[model samples]
Target: MNTLPIRPEIPWLAPLAGYSDLPFRMLCRAHGAGVTNTEMVSAKGLCYFNRGTSSLLNTHPEDAPLVVQLFGADPDSYHQAMDKTLEMGFRFFDLNAGCPVRKVTKSGSGSRLLENPDRLYAIAEIMVNKAGPGAVGVKTRLGWEKGVDTFLDVAKRLEDIGVAWLTLHPRYGKQLFSGQADWSRLAEVKQAVSIPIVGSGDLYTAEAGVRCLRETGIDAVMFARGAMFDPAIFERFHALMRGEESPPRDGEHLARIVRMHIQYTREFDGSDRSFRKLRSFIPRYAKGLRDIRSLRNELISCETWEALESAASRIREMQPADPLGFDPADVIPD
Candidate 1:
């Protein structure tokens, strides 16, 4: 029998609202992302048939093995929305129990669910039943507040309730993005659960990706802001895993991805909104490029695709200041 590779099993692209749109997803896939997730959508919004929510669920032929993430406090609405998701041909569904935004938690969603494991189990059970076997999963943080650890119990419950997988960010809600992620805790959860455990947070480099997988013994790894800064990270990590030297970052290729992303966003969500969304990724794409601050400022101010394309072309002409150490400062916190 041929044994499959276990460590660094899958290169995952995490869902960032407005950032992980189809264009960026396709770019990541082209480069080497193994699995990609959609941005978190409101279960209530989907149940209510909101146009914006519906558009977020849209996927192209190339966007296969996609996971659609849903956020809501009510189990009934979650069930209804997941039913609709399945009707729309999505096989994988993830429940968002980890978002720490004030607006989300205030509504009893996101990280707030960690406060009540029973409720979390109830919701996961309903989604699992609705999604049938091997269709449901959960993504969550370590706990709700500082110094509180609930991931071990949460992971076990999710496994017992038939969750196919679990993605742990390994940070408490109170910590937000500050401080380092507790990788040891992730290791603990990995040992506690039978389901596939995906360890997330602070995996910004290929070295860190390898370190996290080796240290935590996770089934796979998930990339959020790190992927935004370097879309080639997955490919680079894959090369490193195979005992090959990491490839050099190509500024021209990065610029081309930016252009393609802008076009795809425009095609997917017409009007200036798509352009506006594309602006969020500029800082990442332009990281380490000379005078990118000025270039990004100019690009963000452009109101049309033509203008955006012009600015991008100008950015492409300039060489990156530091080829290897250019980390984008505008990473979205998990």
Candidate 2:
């Protein structure tokens, strides 16, 4: 069987909704993310050529080896979407069977796919057959609810279908981001599957990323909320992996990266849509600033990029403060 075409020991950036844009992906890549997946695309949207869906397919030369994640239950829709993605030069694909949103699950997709194992297996089989071996993988959760070991069976099915790799986030569908992620579940799945397993869920710090790899013995680790708050995480984690001292993340570094992210967004889409798209990110970049609450309100309401830049400039000049009540154990939303 073909294996995942990514490096081991390098942390991955998870495909987050409304956050894993090209600009953010580029930053993480530069910061040492071994691989990055695009935000999940609707298979039906791509089959119909929806304008919004088309925008998600955008890529740059620097973002090579990108994994395009698709969500839907229909085999035909997946086939069509895969065709379009391959034509656009995306070589890696991930089927999202873990999304817990009601709107998605209500349609017999996302985590709901877990309720119907045969159908889920069929989807993986179809994706592998259609996209070709080694080009497709899957990202899924433990099961539809707590206390169910459905994932163990599903993982084996996916391996039987020839999936390149399996990225398991050890949370039940109903669990959402509530409660703790069962790392033991990850270890269980790892033992069950022969293919490479990428462990995810609740990994929000460079230290956690390191520990997960060592404890779970999975092939790789993926960061979602952690990367959003600190794109430099991969770089720092990479340094630690190599037994080297991590570079500093002082005020100047944060300011420079914030500026760069804004510039990249502007270049990607020169419109208010992109401007609004960046509003939520400001707080992430300004996470540890003095009085971040006030700074967040100011940035979230900016109407123009210039205004946004002005807000960012003020944040850069402000004195950096230690994180407010920061807990290394807290898992931020993805």
Best by TM-score: 2
Write candidate 2's Cα lDDT for 1-334 as tens digits.
1334554576889988777878888878877887899998999899998889998877898886688988988877877887788788777889889988887898988888999888888878877887787888889999999877699999998998989899998998988888888888888988988988888888877878888888888888889978878888898888888988877666677777788888888877667777777777777766666777888889877888888888887766656677442443343465
lDDT of each: 0.80, 0.81
Candidate 2 is scored at a TM of 0.93
Instruction: Report how far off residue 101 is in candidate 2 (Å).
Output: 1.6
**List of clashing residue pairs for candidate 1:** none
Show model 1 residue runs off by greater than 4 Å: 1-7, 323-329
Q: Give TM per candidate.
A: 0.92, 0.93
Report the C-alpha lDDT of model 1 over 1-334, residue by residue, as the tens digit: 0111224657788877767778778878877888888989999999888888888887888887788888888888877887788889888888999988888889889989999878888889988898777777799999999778888888887888989888899888767778888899888988887878787889887778878988988888888877888888888788877888877665686777787777777776666666676776766777777887888789778887788888888756767687454543456665
- Per-candidate clashes come to 0, 0
Candidate 2: where are CA atoms >4 Å away?
Answer: 1-5, 323-332
